[model samples]
Target chain A: MRSRADVVVIGGGIVGLSTAYHLAKLGADVVVLEKGYVGSGSTFRCASGIRAQFTDEANVKLMKYSVKRWKELSDELGYDVGFVQTGYLFLATTEDEADVFRRTVKLHRRLGLGTRIIDMDEAREIVPILNTEPFILGQWNPEDGKASPFKSTFAFLMRAREMGVEVHEYTPVTAILVENGEVMGVKAGDRTIKADAVLNATNAWAPLVNEMAGLDRELIPIKPFKHQLVKTEPIKPGLVNPLVSPPSWNDSYIIQDAEDGGVIGGAGVEHGPTYDVTPTYDFLREVVRWMTRIAPPLKYVHIIRQWAGFYAKTPDSNPVMGEIKYVNGLYIAAGFSGHGFMMAPGVSEAMADLIMKGRTKVPLDWEWYDPHRFERGELRTSAFQIG
Target chain B: MQMRAPKGVMVLGQTDGEDPRENIIICRCNEVTQKDVEDLIDRGITDIEEIKRLLRIGMGPCQGRTCIPLVMGIIARKTGRRMEDIKVPATRVPIRPVPAGVLVGELDEE
Candidate 1:
């Protein structure tokens, strides 16, 4: 690796590689450091669903912008990221939950998103096999979609390398070298690479990296939570085009990949915060129970694999972006909770703008994702978090 | 009745097939040819999981039972790495393919 660089970004997932690509496009020298191979972290384990049907206005706007970028990403990178606009469906089983959907639909419509509250008939039209007995209403957004996380992450990495960005795999940063309250660089093994700026893009490991920089955990409280998912053997393609979310069934979500015909699904289980990524038998049983309840045909399918990953959760379930005020030349783009894969495109563009020009051009409410929100007591309502 | 060859095995004295080596199928379920596996290896993707995700090599009903060892051998030959150095894909639950109906307590009607 080079002994010096203009900027060093930590992490090699979608966020880190996309940020490196954007930074290089803006004429900034960039270097990306990863503890493992690219996309081996949370990016590979993500469900890969993208949507703009969020309750929060800022989140909706950000996702809408991200969807636009995702549509054009394949052409821009000259590699197919497997982005398909198969739509996202959210089901509500009670009147209270339906009321929340109504409010969210209003907010989504106001933000220029093509989301609407659909009746049972319209919901059945979208997904014919859906069990209508469980849900009273549904939220549908046709613009929302899914992409292949491996393709997307590698697309960014390959393009970033072509644009003069240096990426080093298996190079773990041992310590953040801070001198006289200013960011110097990082020490990896026996070598020290001095950089003008350092960005902490390591999602689940952000808190640990921040502590290495001598920042208090209370300043940026990021906790890791383990979530598991399962993939069934290939059924028939296009069986389930849209991502199906049944909020009453432990927040279960299901989607079928068009390329492989495999039905991928998962559900949230109550567990304490930890970094352990061991998949549990209890999770498989719970998720399968809810999945088979929604669609009986899935009961005949065979599960092929199950794995777990971490979500770098914040207090309000939004990301923490922008520069750190306590330390000069130190920036961070982390705490995405579980939505990092969907939000990577827009977040990278906005982060690049913030780093080079001290502001973002995207029309997002930046204050909602301020890194110091917990300290300022200005935490907004958590976005409608689901699989 | 004539006995047909297995899904991925090549029959001897078959001269009608064109480019016999490249046409050889490695993943019978996914129809992934030797060319497909070699092209990805040529592009510097040696990781078994990445290859599986990109090409759907081991995602079929057999769950890598028929193709993983063959693909690992090809990777070892192309990258000049020892077979032991190549990491194997992680094995998951339901070692034998168990239908989801069995997990949810659904039995066949008598």
Candidate 2:
């Protein structure tokens, strides 16, 4: 890239580009290095589900803030992100899950989220295609919605570039140069761009980037696990309103993509700590079974595309944000556990505040996501994470 | 050198037919023409995975079954790299569209 810049962001996905946009807005010269094209990482494989429903107060607050930003992101980016406010419906299969969901709903409402524990009838009404048999209880939040990944991410990338940010596609950050525990520059491709600040936005590749800066032990529990999402061919739209999910956390998510008429969702797996992002036949079968049950109409809609991408999962299935304790001028906005695509705006803005000032407007204890949390066994887990 | 066989019919730079197939639609599922793929290659998307994502070439209903050979041939010729060296992304299973009944059977195994 350029011989010098104020900050070098490693990764051109939504998180990286959003951080670049926020950093540029803060009057910092930024260069983004992406080995692949923008929106081609975990972003491309997203089902585009956005929700404010979480069991933990930190996540609930973070998602509430994220939802507020997403509602107005279209206007800010000057492009239609296809932000269809289809709401989010969580189906609880067992009595225990129903009890947990009810408690979670109360907590969410107290946190200023319009979440409620609803009956199966309401769930079916929201998404008429839902079978409503296996679900004993459902949680509905009309404020949550979905957005198009490619369009929204490209919007951030374009806006960042327009704001004097240098984004180099096909230029991967090979190494992060640190001197005296302070940031220096990054070796991207062949050129070394000097940076007083460096952001490790490389979610799945966090280990590799941190190792370059001699901070490998900080994120020892972070690993990239493959998740597969499938899409059906253009079906008649409006069949499903809210994104639907089964109680079996990972294996159940079904929502409509407003941009294209295809209904998109995923088949979740438990085995991980592997970087293999290969789509398996197993996922297709599981997805079909779980999704069709939630929305029976999916049985007829033929799947058009199947793809897999990485989820940079931390040990607690939550994100690791903020700066490394030992490295000055080095910040982390990685390990989002597949929620990165939906929460990019909030995370990016918070990271920008953390880098520019020592604090963030995000009211939650953003420091809880510190990379060193694992070493101290101070991990905070989010109870609900729909793959 | 991973000696993987070409996945589809090589048609990008093939000169066998009298009418130039260069302008023809190779990925019928996604309506990706030869020119569309070549332009992506010109922009340095020589890798098959990038070409699929950017141009939507091999990401359609038929997957890459109809377009891989045409793309691989063009990439090899353009980049001066041997076919073995050209890395194509993984070809996932469920190659044929399975009926709902077969899918249920797979779920039952779990």
Candidate 3:
């Protein structure tokens, strides 16, 4: 509604706000159009588990870059992002799984991460409440942490605003104005906010937005899977401070918040891809079944709350970043799966660099995530999981 | 009969029956206290939806059935927003628990 801007980032979640913040910092006029309140999307509903224990090189590099940024984010943004490095522990049961994890540990060490494969005894030492009967090996990175999702999103929004970015909540982008296969502007509500470039950070709803540009059929389906998480009542403090990834991922991960001491966890995320965020009774049941064996203490723990979120899953579980080659000035920043929350710092910097300087100096190779990679039959796999 | 109560010792016992405040639980499921809602409002959470997401006021397994009105009342009173203006987030399906048995047969999801 401000007539026009240098760029229009469609989506006010953390990704869009981070993009706007970087773009505005680089002296570009940015207008963020949020269909709902900022962070009201999957940003606020995520389990807020920030980890760097990845099997893929690209993901590991991105998260390794992110962990450093998160450490310095509060100072940079002038707001406490509530980053707590409680560590992320993965439980491996089978011998084959443990062997794979041992190799992963070497890869992690080479990447400058402190991820080491510890025996079951060390796992119990790390988390006193952990039930070690189900597992033999554990993978842990002492530095992998989580932050306040709402706080970080709000901080990014504030910094972006301070940099002169105009954020319009309740402003849904209706269409993207294109001409001659070149980028143009975006239509939001009744007004046309003309711009030379546009970034699609609409996550789960990217498919609908892609349709406006007449590029729907060409892209791989980024389905929206409904994932749910539950929070337990404040439990007595124990050594179980680190976030524990259940053996086999078992559709669950448990972590006690540093502040509230509330054990936040979830499982049974095999829920089908739908816009429906309805938390099912199945999740509560699964939580009980898994919690009973994973952590004996949580068997009868009261589930104080439960909420659902969307995992914007791509064909390979890897995000499709960088620019859409065929569409000039049109950048793709969504499809980060569940890791989008933690990887925002790196992704935003790369996207901003690509938009401003025509390239990113970040260690990541953007070509691997090209939107047209599927067309060339080059599907990349990522080791991250969602519950 | 000998006096059993210690003179200066703090009595550690259930006080719900003695103190009216202890029994007054806004959201019985989430155990949200009235003070909790007010404290959130003090922190500048004017919108109902924002409060819902942050405090998990209406996010229990009962799906806000018991807490929505109570939370809305607190928000409406504090923010001066009319009840109609402070909309409750729509409750989605599977309001009741869906047995895993239902989801097991259809493993091949496209």
Tens-place lDDT digits, model 1, residues A1-387: 788887899999999999999899889989999998887779988888999888878898899999999999999988889999999999999999999889889888888999989888888888777888888999999999999998899899889998999988888989999989899999888978899899999998898889989998768888889998888888877778899998878889899876787888889874548877778988888888988888788988887778888788998889998898888988999999899999999999988888877887776567788899899877778867786
Q: How far in Å is the alpha carbon of B25 misplaced in model 1?
A: 2.3
Residues A250-336, model 3: lDDT tens digits: 757788866556677777455777898778877766765665567876754555666788888888888888787667888887777
DockQ of 3: 0.10
* DockQ category of candidate 3: incorrect
Per-chain TM-score (chain B), model 1: 0.75
lDDT (Cα atoms) of all candidates against the true structure: 0.85, 0.78, 0.78
Give per-residue CA lDDT, model 2, range A1-387, as digits (tens): 478888889888889999899989999999999987777677877778888787888878887888888888889977656677788888888898888888888888789988888898877777767788888988889998888786777678768888999988878888888899899999975789998889988888888888888975445567888888877766677777678887575557888876556788776664467777767878877888877777776766666667788878888888888888788998888888888987888888888888887788876466666777888888686546784
**Weakest 10 consecutive residues, lDDT, candidate 2 chain A?**
A215-224
Better of 2 and 3 by TM-score: 3
The list of candidate 1 runs beyond 4 A from truth reads B1-21, B108-110
Better of 1 and 3 by TM-score: 1
Q: TM-score of B chain for each model?
A: 0.75, 0.66, 0.69
Which window of 10 residues has the lowest lDDT sum in candidate 3 chain A?
A: A297-306
In order of DockQ, best first, we have: 1, 2, 3
